[model samples]
Target: MSTKPQFGADIETHHTRFDVDRYEDIYVVGDVHGSLDALKRLISRLELNNDDLVIFVGDLVRKGPDSPGVVDFVRADPCLVSVRGNNEQKILRGDKDPDWLREGDREYFESLPIAISFDTVLVVHGGVDPERSLEDHATDELLTMRSPHGDGYDGPFWYDDYDGPHRVFFGHTVHDRPVEREHAVGLDTGCVYGGELTAYDYRNDEFRTVASKTHQDRASSKVVDPA
Candidate 1:
């Protein structure tokens, strides 16, 4: 919405369906606050192949210029798998709704899943809350929750000490650019907030970035050696 986001406690709107495990070579992006132009530039950079599965870490709308455009792109792309971002969740749950969209947008935002738990990792918009079980986590928790003591592996997109086989990738916190923790990694790059939008190449363990047009945020993509 046009105002600052307010994530409410009720989370039933996110009780929708989701993917059990349907991605690989995942090209995950962080917090796209309606930067349709920047998103297009990043997508063009990908030159994605049919096998390159794309995962979006949510917050794909609001706070930027083109909320509707972002949704249109995500809907058109077959290779893309998106989770319900915190902003989208706010609209879906009717907590602080804004006129960011004209019409038909609510349906699109309402359709997104809360989480996509894979064999390797869990993909979410904001960090997952550790206070509840994976199944116990409400859509609100998955959509708009973050924890400070996220060093533990109780949830998907929060922890910094993930020692499991798969790595959790997400966005929402652009304060720390390219945070590489053991439990989870944040790649927001703050593109829409004058930060660069980042992409992590999992197979090659590489990072790539495209500068934002609206903002001057910058990030030099680097590989994090696995411990």
Candidate 2:
């Protein structure tokens, strides 16, 4: 009898997971969306140390003024890591790389995993279907699914439906404020759209934000209630 295939078993298949346990503190940032200056200010406020790590919920590029700058900054710092957001996936799938992407930046972006796991916490760019295992989730689901039913930005979000063994932290569904739930937390506070760039302190169960300096797109913004 055939057994279930392992996710990320091959280099070609997606669903790669990273495990981080050495950090003294772990902070998961919302979608950067190329808001480099805002990200700089937020990092300054954090005053992170060598023992601390900062993880991005993805969408590090596109929508803001400095996609290349954000990519460079994150790549230069060893303390920073990210999951592959839909925007990043777009770059990977496109026939040509973005004109702004510097040499070697594409490879670094490609290296990003689909999910980052810290014991009971799971980080993804979008989110998983609560009822399915990580291995069962498609690449699109891990990178872009907001509602399990369809892409409609209506009631009954996936977070409301989630009853998790691992509390999920995601950033694709742009919100005016953070999406807070018992089993999932959404950190995409629409930083590229003149909203605050937010971060979640996993150890303290707290949130921190830095106000956006630019408004690139208003169409993606949403105001949703926490579960």
- Stretches off by above 4 angstroms in model 1 are 1-24, 130-132, 148-158, 161-166, 215-227
Number of clashing pairs, model 1? 10
What lDDT is obtained when candidate 2 is compared to the true structure?
0.81
Error of 2 at 142 (Å): 0.3
Q: How well does candidate 2 score on lDDT at residue 211?
A: 95
Residue-level lDDT for 17 in candidate 1:
27
Per-residue CA lDDT of candidate 2, range 114-203, in tens? Answer: 777666677889887867766667778878888888776785678888887678899888787898888889999889888899989877
Q: Rate the local accuracy (lDDT) of all candidates.
A: 0.65, 0.81
Off by over 4 Å in 2: 1-21, 95-97, 220-223
